[model samples]
Target: MLDRVITISREFGSGGRELGMKLSEKLEIPFYDKELISLTAQETNMSVTEFLNYYESIPVTEQSLEPPLYTSFSPLYEIPISDQVFLAQSRVIKSLAEKGPCIIVGRCADRVLEDSINLFIYAGIEHRIERIISLNKDLDPQLVENKIRETDRKRKDYYQYYTGCEWGKAQNYHLCLDSGLAGVEGCYQAVLSYLGHCI
Candidate 1:
């Protein structure tokens, strides 16, 4: 049986990927993040760009924009093609879980593998703009703020639309982290400690 499955979810510029990678090394488990999307694209015969365009963004339904009053001619309410692709992604995630313990990052993976011994971690910073600036030296504050906000919004909408749950809620995860507080290695150690205790 698989020992555990770790899902690292994050706000934009939260260093979740870095944390996931380090944790994977410490735990000696495979890590899946962008690879999940790439694998799904290969299985579905869709280009990565095409697959990402629809599912990676905020679903139109969740936005504050006014809904179309009439559906006579519009197919807006119909499921986007990415939903089908996500089904494929979910299958791949399950397959990996069956293979053995692993760490998965951001594809609604926590919800996808909710039945397993799951460890859900979220990383964010109180001063997101400054954190982004520090992490990415060349980017200006305005651009970083806009980019961070847009990416987080997309992730939030995607998780809510796909899993029917609010994104970034503490209840959705086993542990929540602030990179500014824990730093990458500290966050990784926390996850290790929890996994050691639980798994």
Candidate 2:
């Protein structure tokens, strides 16, 4: 049977979102990326800005020390805000997957969807730096590189914190594509071909 859900986890500036959009168009399925933020905000009765702040902010313990040691006395509400947002989004991802075939970009969708086809997209640091600089012409090259590194680190940590699995590992995904080598369109086509063969 055709896989109804495709989950893409990508490195910063790897064009994975672009590839996901292309695949959605070719496959005639809905694509979700930032749209999940809106859905999550609505579900939690929080504004988009508030949701983003919670979503992007890593827990304090995760930054400066080892994972926190929570005592049995701690209540569920005492959980880190980032973890709460992740759990909320996980619910949204699962609900969307149950709806039918769709393309979900990031938000740990691969880990959340039990039957989805998971793809990891990544590129070299140099390639990512160049891509970020090209997209943001006004920003300094060094600044762009720093931003890329920081964003990638945050994403990696977030994925690992939630899933207890290393992000971007080939073994964690069904297919891993190098966007630097394949380009966006090529990556999309490769995923489509792979899905065809598997389905």
Which structure among the candidates has the greatest TM-score? Answer: 2
lDDT of 1 at 13: 77
Local distance difference test, each candidate: 0.71, 0.81
The sequence of per-residue lDDT tens digits that candidate 2 reaches over residues 1-199 is 4657999999989998888888888888999999998898886678887888887455775453344332222354666766666667777888888889999999878888788899999999888878777777787878877888899999998788667789988999999999888777788888878998885
Best by lDDT: 2
lDDT of 1 by residue, 20-121 (tens): 899788778898988887788887677877777755653354542332221122342354455556666777888898888888888888888866443444
TM-score of 1: 0.82
Model 1: residues >4 Å from true position, as ranges?
A: 58-79, 117-126
